[model samples]
Target: MNLSLEITGLTKSYADSGFMLDNVSLAIPSGTIMGFVGENGAGKTTTIKSILNTVQIDSGTIRLLGKEMTDRDTALREDIGVVLDSANFSAILTPGKLAKVMRGIYRQWDQELYVRLTDKFALPMNRKIKEFSRGMTMKLAIAAAMSHHPKLLILDEATSGLDPITREEILEVFLEFVEDEHHAILMSSHITSDLEKIADYITFIHQGKIILTAMKDELIYDYGVARCTSDQFRRIAEGDRLAYRVKEHQTDVLVKDRRGFGQQYSGIMVDQVSIDEILLLLVKGEN
Candidate 1:
């Protein structure tokens, strides 16, 4: 498979907070949306910053579009579109002026596409960015990101403030972006429901460590959340167990192979799991 981004042993540490990205690694394939998820302060933003070369790492290598990322690689940087939690554009500039500024920055900036997207998103061109709502600012960031005709997109909390309908519309645009085999996206959001709807692969991090990386369907369907009594939990083999939590009446066990476990223990109940449920169980449950 052709990879759009690859990180190996990507590690970073903060002096005061003691937060560390401990040996993080993942691969994002072309034409796929990779949902980067974790709780706050779990290194999701740190990882993205490292990938963009904004944060210096202690040790590791990052490869984007088959080339190692370097601070001076303007060409490589241009191929990647990045949208952060908050855009840093001057509050006084209108979207129309921002477009002109962006045109000078990106070699491949498409003015026509920018106008179309702005219209599609229903953003006011004449209003200053500070006057725009949270949703409008986010939409404008997305419009700028897409207008660059980038091969890769990196979005951090891009969907957090938008209403469900707007989020759905933006997600459809993401789907269209990756319709071509050469395009890819790495998106990090607390909104797991949105990720569930659009992401092809899900990579989950917890406390600065990667816990799981798997296909969305496999994580959702093949993995099982088994509710069993303490006695029944003891019967589950160690190799099949991923994580488990004790509830008031029973134990919730996350099993690697739901089908195999179901077939092995005919009477046991193996329930389907959502991305959010799985994340909760992994982050809060016992191994």
Candidate 2:
């Protein structure tokens, strides 16, 4: 498989907060979307910044489009389109002027594509970006990112401010982009529902450490949430559970196999788990 983005032993630390990305590693294959999930302060942005070389890394290797990341390689960067949580567009520039500015920077810039994307996103072409709402700014950023014909897109909370309809439209555009097989996306988002709808794989990070990475379908169909009393919980085999949390009256367990666990236990309820619930169980449960 061809990987568009690969990180090995990616580590970074901040002195102020003592927050560190501890030996983080993952890969996004071409033609697939990797959903990066975690709560606030879980090193999602830090990991991305380290990969982009915006912040200095203490140690690690980051490869983009199969080339090692280096400051001298502008060509490698041109192949990537990045949208962070906040876009820093010039306040006075309209969508028209922004297009002109980008054309000067990216050699592969497609003005026609930019125009079409702006129209599709319903962005005001003539209005100054400072006067636009947060959602409009985000849409403008996404338009700019896609218009350059990048091979890989790295999006950080890119859909936070948009309404449901707009989010759906933007997601459709993303799906269309990844259909090329030479294209891929690594999207870090709080919106797990969107990830559930679009992502091929899910990677969970907590407290600056990777908790798990697995296929989306495997997690949805094979993995399960097992509910049982304390006695039944103690009876559950250690090999079957990824993690388990005990409540006052019920013990919620994350089982590796839903149907298999049902057959093994006979009476304990083994239910399907969502991506969000998986994250919650993994983060809050004990191994």
Global lDDT scores for all candidate models:
0.93, 0.92
Q: Which stretches of candidate 2 lie above 4 Å from their native place?
A: none
Per-candidate TM-score against the hidden true structure: 0.98, 0.98
lDDT of candidate model 1 versus the reference? 0.93
lDDT of 2 by residue, 2-112 (tens): 999999998898999899999999999999999999999998999889888999998889989999888999998889999989966888999999999999999999999
Best by lDDT: 1
